[model samples]
Target: MATFNVRPDIDAAAEKLGSTMGAKREIKRLPEVLWEGETVEMLATGSYGGGTGLVAMTSMRLVFLKHGVMSQTVEDFPYPKISSVQWQGGMLMGTLTVYTSGNRADIKNMPKDQGAALSDKLRALIAQGGQPAAAPAAAPAQDVGSRLATLDQLRATGAVSDAEYQERRARILDSL
Candidate 1:
């Protein structure tokens, strides 16, 4: 699946929601619109901490309707369909919206299946969105002098066995 960094504000909100619901939930990196409104936007939901377990989103319209809180369809929110999703830093992120509807849409009383489907859809979409960015290269090798110094400190602190020190010293010397 696609990975994403959870925004602090959104993370906190999801955490709070999880606490209130008393379920095993956590903020995910993926995002989705699933609907279309006047403005267009994506929606994301995960197990916060309370009762909101692994819920998914695929269609904002379906999401709202499932929640029993709907006034229009996907063409009501801001964005329409799956626009984009990718990894930023260490998190998956995406954009979504409703089209042709009003200015805003919401979900409060949707069915569990639909709510969950929406979440699953978002996750799946993220996986299909694109390949994630690569991580930075590893740190360069440290100089032998520094490694010896560290080994000395470790020995003084009784942090290494005599055998360990010898083995490490040999390795350090080989690197020189």
Candidate 2:
């Protein structure tokens, strides 16, 4: 068996999340993407597209990570960007879908119990306005400026609409 140097708190949290074989395998890799001080609240194992991965609900966001033999994929949905989460359950498995402004991600074949628990926890978090007890420290002014410049470039390239540029600009400013 492979071992990862996961923090004690994260290991304990994963223990509470579930004990399925998939969950156990995936949870070991979570420390790779988790930010400093980020707390894992829940974890579920499932398939997204053609990849089998784990979705971890943390204090700041939902992270989906897939580790393959030669490549890895990671996707993060910050609480502020998520509009809603939906769960559909059958006897043994379920699907959890997450919606953002213009994107949706469906994680299917999750164990029913894990999916339902994650859905309820996410709903409560959203209901509470997706604010964690302690907000992360503000970014440096240079970082903020860089983000603004990137947003401007996206607008200039027509990658993001004027409305999107404005919204993203305001979010970056608000973080300051």
Candidate 3:
């Protein structure tokens, strides 16, 4: 087993994974391994969503080991090799080397810093566990509405050309 510091933003990765996967996977501190480990047990499984509306799902059974790495085994679903695991602070970061080339929703378009940031934020939130702060006053909901109001004020003072205002207004509304 190998150990590494949890990145500061690993909470985000965990949160994202939890949200997408429908549950928070637990982690346990291993006495013998001296490392972090997720608390989920498993048989072999893999899922992939399509670019269209369909999703692919598959599963298989495997010989179980009482003390094997779930994270490493999961990465082997579409392939047949154990992935590497690293521990950061209170979180575990692991590589899904076999699935890296595809657009899996859980891993797609993920910002590298996001996971560490998420982990740090989650730790803070857990430490300060309490009701959320009361809502601040809501800003206007529509982006165009706010931009148009600002544009109106600017236009009243001839701050923008008619053509410029029209172009900007069109762009903002189109974004909606």
User: What's the TM-score of each model vs. the native?
Assistant: 0.22, 0.69, 0.22
Per-model CA lDDT versus the true structure = 0.34, 0.75, 0.28
Put the candidates in TM-score order, highest first.
Answer: 2, 1, 3
Give one digit per residue, the lDDT tens place, for model 1 in 26-103.
222112212111111223332222222223322232232112122212222211443432221212322122223333
Could you tell me which 10 consecutive residues in candidate 2 have the lowest summed lDDT? 1-10
Reference-based TM-score, model 2: 0.69
Q: Write the per-residue lDDT of candidate 3 for residues 1-176, one digit (tens) a residue.
A: 21111221222223333232211111111111111111111211112221111011112111111222233112212212212212132233321112213422232222224334432432333344311223233244443464566556545645456987787678657756
How high is the lDDT of residue 151 in model 1? 63
Model 2, residue 67: what's the lDDT? 75
- Which model is ahead, 2 or 3, in terms of lDDT? 2
Instruction: Specify the highest-TM-score model's number.
Output: 2
The deviation in Å at residue 78 for candidate 2 is 0.3
| Alpha-carbon runs more than 4 Å astray in model 1 | 1-142
Best-fitting candidate, scored by lDDT? 2
Which runs of model 3 end up more than 4 angstroms from their true locations? 1-140
- Which window of ten consecutive residues has the lowest lDDT sum in model 1? 31-40
